[model samples]
Target chain A: MLNKVEAYFTKELKEKAGILVVLTLLLLVPQYSWRLFFLLLLIASLLPRDVHRGKIKLMVSLPFSKGDVFWISYAFLITIIVITQIIGGAFFNISLSGIGWDILGTLIFSSAYFGIAMISVSLGFGNFGIPFLVLIADSFFGAIGNNWEFTYNLFRSPSGLNPYRMISPIYQGNRFAAFVFAAALLITAYILFERKGTSK
Target chain B: MIVKVENLQKSFSGKFVLNGVSFDVKEGEMFALIGPNGAGKTTTLRCLYGDLTPNGGKIELFGKAFSSKSKERIAVMNEERETFRRLTGGDYVKMWSLLYPKWNDKIFSNFALHYKFDLEQRVETYSIGMKTVFYVALTVASNADVLILDEPTQHLDPLIRNEILKVISNYTLEEKKTIIISSHEIYELEEISTSFAIIKEGKVLYSDTVDDAKASHRLISRDEKASQGEVIGLVGDDTLVKTDKDVGRFPKFEEIVLGYLGGRREFIPF
Candidate 1:
């Protein structure tokens, strides 16, 4: 069990660590911050595909249980989330000041997204899930990109967009959204990780 | 029994890659899966090692029902370069060894020594054959009764190929371990395989013991006048059907078959 877990981290997270750092640096560079969320989704989905690919042929031939799938996914997601948090905050300057609510949101987003990426890339045949994920994510990203200043007003940013809209005035709209992003990811990850695949 | 697959079936796009495939691997038996490209051989091997989930199959390993998640009894030598390029061969083995409950560094190092694999060098600098040797050592080090190998000989030199096969064959004989190997080299399989299965076009065309496969079919050839026996085999650039049999020395039969296979074909002249 420990070996599987370790392999999951090393293969899915550590193996991709360099890329993750490079990507985080890319996201932090002022103007390119717009690409951060979408890139995050893409990177998360890409990590485990190779390991899963190698295993897909064997898993289909052998006997696998849902619990095994869930654990594998969970293990992978945690590593990704931890890496994302470390890189995002330490280097990219993605803050986590007040908004205690943000942590819950981050955890959720991390879990959901980690799971989503796990299931999406783990598909046996085509890239059906990727397009589906991109369709929804791209549109949302587009909305945010075009109206970065506008969304600042809606979800009640900590303070940047609106002087008195939210209690934690120090929190920027992007910060709150990151937490929400984390929440969204968590919900999705758990669902995908738990969902029964067509195979069995 | 080391492993048992019951009523296994895997489908993609409504087509079954492995359909109702079932079998028992006796302890210490070296089994081979021989089939054409796109055959269920790789798929079947994947299912055995927890790399895939069968649409409908139950696997019992070491007297326990193995669900998709229950993988405490098997080891797999997967295809996509399991070793991290930056890590030394020894470190890679040790890293994985820590995770496996059944890992035995002694056995792994012994296999590495036998194979002449350099343990101190970074894995990425080595060739594919070297990586395979490292993977085999790590997997064997796990000491899992069941070892699932997919295309272990792909891209391997003849000498290395024989060496790996020798290790697997010898291990199964000396220890009561079970190995499932998928390969295109039917003749090499003939030498060491106790059981065999053939997959073609995403299905199990036939699966049985080596003796049964040999007994069930005959490889007869003709110069120009072919017999009426149905074609039941693949010969060079043609198919051998008994009913439409025009068996000539398939252009370059000996050279083509042996060359492509790395000299692993056993022909029965008829």
Candidate 2:
């Protein structure tokens, strides 16, 4: 696993360097909303880049399996997100203990989005198209749900409210339900990636 | 057998691309899969290496069911030659050395030197032929037991093509490794491949050892329609027939492949 990670890092050195620059710039922003937006953009684009470019087939041709690829990529994404969030919090002089929930929330949100992006890519949808559309719709609805009580209740009732609220700005929804939704999405994405024909 | 594929079926959208393609590749033999475009050659290779899961069929590698572990012993060079285009040749060596447990840097370096590759330059800067050679070199250096190469010698001059073919032939001979190569260079492959399977429209029309395939089939004059042996196809003024009787002259490997793939050629009256 370590070898695979080292190989992946070496292969993607240039892209990772560019990501570091973007991340540094992201740290300069004071608003969490903007930071989250850019972070999600990074996740949406970077996580599925290999699949979109048809490089996943090449990767799998090596000793690595599809499961290894998926988990390694997902773990790498989570690691980067956690590390950056910690740095951002420290740089802004926020207490680490107080920001634990903030970090968890960000991680959950990112995992859900990553799952959606991966599923889209595995299903032959371009990396940016479906995920970007989903982000737009989520933000639009999340905003309305936050501002309107009736709208929030309508979404929160029974029609898959937990998954939607996971990405919403309002933190009043059930966290457990959100976690289950994210887990389900990631599992489904992994299965699709395993079964899908990776030849390009 | 090193690789066994039975009743392989694959469909794209709603139509079938590979309908029950089957073949067996023995250990330490150079097996060739030759066919025209859209004959499911690349698709079969992909499925063999686990790049594509067949909708129905069985693939056994190393005398066991094909799995992720099987890939550890298999080195595949896909048709696209896909890689990190921004990375240099040196970067590939470094990355592959880490990925492949049996990687031999000396082999890769020797090939790089022989091919006159500039290791510092990005892979995208290399010509198509160079990229193909580079990928082949990497696959060879991987030192795996099984090498599945799809169009290994595509887009090269005659001299370089022959050199690549020799390198492939030598790899199997010196290392005693198994190779499943797909190619349109039937004449060139005929010299090196020990056995071959001619595929057409997602079916294996004929598969046998090079010696047997040539010995069993004969090309006779088209005018002399054979009363013995099954007629395979027409080749210009000749008819390719499979028979045990002493009739027409023995067919070359390319003739047999062309007969199976092209069949009877239709000419337009001008």
Please name the candidate that would achieve the greatest DockQ relative to the true structure.
Answer: 2
* TM-score (C-alpha, index-matched) for candidate 2: 0.92
Reference-based lDDT, each prediction: 0.57, 0.82
For model 2, how does the per-residue alpha-carbon lDDT over B46-106 read when each residue is reduced to its tens digit? 8888878899999999999988877878888878776676788888888778877899989
lDDT of 2 by residue, A1-200 (tens): 69888877666556567775776578446586687677667776565877887777777778788888888888877777777777778888889785677677777677777888899988888887787787777776665545677767676555534455653432416667667767777899889888885655
User: By TM-score, who's the top model here?
Assistant: 2
TM-scores of the candidates are 0.65, 0.92
Cα DockQ of the candidate 1 complex: 0.20
Residue A197 shift from truth in candidate 2, angstroms: 3.0
Once superposed on the true structure, which residue ranges of model 2 sit more than 4 Å away at CA?
A27-30, A136-172
* Candidate 1 positional error at B232, Å: 7.2
- Chain B of candidate 2 vs. true chain B, TM: 0.96
Name the 10 consecutive residues with the lowest summed lDDT in model 2 chain A.
A163-172
Worst ten-residue run, lDDT, model 2 chain B?
A: B259-268
